[model samples]
Target: MSFKKRGPFVSLQLMSRWKNLVGLNVSIGGFVGKYPHCFEIFTHPFRRNLCCKITQKLKEVIVEEENVIRECEIDAVKRVKKLLLMSKNRVLRVHALRLIRKELGLPEDFRDSVLAKYSLDFKLVDLETLELVDDDDDDDDESLGVAKVEEWREVEYREKWLSEFEMNYAFPINLPTGFKIEKGFREELKNWQRVAYVKPYERKDMSRGVERFEKRVVAIIHELLSLTVEKMVEVERLAHFRKDLGIEVNVREVLLKHPWIFYVSTKGSTQTVFLREAYSKGCLIDPNPVYNVRRKMLELVLLKNRHSKELSRTGDETHEEKSDVVISSHDDWEGERDGDWVLPILMKSD
Candidate 1:
């Protein structure tokens, strides 16, 4: 779960590698039996413990969502557009983007989908950097397709206020119900709430400036949240890539520092931070195609649970512990017989 990037499934055997994994008390086979939809237990053919793989249905759902992401590349490019425009050089490092690309719901080949199609709006420089450029070459270029970002923001602007005072609307904050506050917390909250606000896409020169560091932090975090479908994430998950997001080591303090722009939910044991502007009445108002596909995947997982429950009544177990298997001295799943299949194929070809 810690090392693997976003994938179709996670291997439960990783607990063996870490050894100190807490809270997981069940055997691998029993765990798969519990969530038949999300996981499938497979014999490694050599390794003693069973290996967990994603079901075929999960793979199909993943592939379908990949197509959906491809169709929604324009939305992704707009996100990239806003992100690059937020940066000082109108460019961002590709490797850093790689870390959060899936979270942003960008196609694996976003360069081909966004930059290649609209050559003037975006440019890939020296293969490692993505830069935002003017599309002055073709004034009528619309091949990149229309994105929901523009229309959605326009609607928000109109609905929130009349033409004159539209900018003054307060972004709502939602804290978890059980959160506790210390003495004088209200006075501190008021002091932190007064930071100057900057629109994400607009450029500001904060260098050699006072009180600008927190404002820039807000802008970067706001834009990062905007890129996510949920407009929120596990506090620890976001903390893992603070440097990649260009925030300071202790920058998560900024969330506690500014209560107006962020909301911390302590519903779970750990905290979940949310962009207060992104939600209304505890529900997200954004229309994200990526988010829709994720919901579809959840629905399929639920359906798989139902199907598994019915099938299990036939006395066919989902996973069974193999008592006779030996724990090999090898570290990886494969042992001395790893390359044995290649030799037979080579001999047959001769």
Candidate 2:
């Protein structure tokens, strides 16, 4: 029986190798399951085309959305013209165009958002560049037809998890003038505030997550301006520590987002120190831990704020490392306001 099975194994090996040569990309598990079936059909060459035919069918299924999106683009171009004319200023025009394209079921690529950020630069002014016109170009030239617009549309149209500001006349309230509330600005605000300030909550409702969500996301962002003062206090602590130990790390590339405090060493390496733990432990001290941590924390709290670029960006790897680190807020799940998602902006300088 063993000798008789040798011929079958050889034929199976040949068929498996042939499948690989044809670039079928099927898994070995499926190939093993189909081995017995392949032997009976070996004499028939046409049966081998099954794998190729299946691969083509899968590709067609994936590409079917492309045609639907092409039609969506044709409709969007007509709508954008009307939207552009109705907008008040360059900033409002960008927001209006984004809303209209979203409403018309057209895509807004990341590039479109970026262009919207600097809409003043790309306006169709009374100029001499006729070559800039391209009929093939859709209004969302930034998406480059990878169907990002379609994906965004799907997210926008979902019954649940609708953007709170969508179709609502409510602008970002409690904001000073010269600032516009753009989509996804909350993400940037949270990151900036996290870097800029650190404060303890006396009451649970006054906690970062609860109070922040109840107010406009921008209000939480403006609160970060206080963080500059926090940084000065942190630097003073670092100065005291270095003076005691007589060692100088200089603490360059410092990113002081409290509760998950981060900084870079003299070697340009990253170090994250939790302020709560560091203060409690001997790692962060001002001659005494129990008596001084509270008084020292409050004494410099009222100082004027100043901006420092030292903690802005470290490097690409440090940013990537941040992603792998889990960052769950102490109060992530409690109910509050809707538009309160925060994310970080990758500044150019490390």
For residues 1-350, what per-residue lDDT tens digits would candidate 1 score against the true structure? 22132222223344234323322354444444555665555444434444455555556667777887788877777677666655666777776666556667776676666667877667888677877786546433332222223344456577865342332322334454576778997675444444444444445544343455655566567667767766776566666445534455465787886676787776524566777767767556875777766765666545544656443221222532222223333354333223111100000000
Worst 10 residues of 1 by lDDT: 341-350
Clashes of 2: 5
Task: Give me the runs in candidate 1 sitting further than 4 Å from their true place.
Answer: 1-33, 44-49, 109-118, 135-170, 175-198, 207-212, 233-249, 264-272, 277-283, 299-307, 311-317, 320-350
Q: What is the lDDT of residue 346 in candidate 2?
A: 10
**TM-score of structure candidate 2:** 0.17
C-alpha lDDT score of every prediction, in listed order: 0.54, 0.27
- Number of the top-ranking candidate, with lDDT as the measure: 1
Full-model lDDT, candidate 1? 0.54
Number of clashing pairs per prediction, in order:
0, 5
lDDT for each residue of candidate 2 in 28-77, tens digit (9 for 90 to 100)? 32433332211111111222211111112222322343344344453444
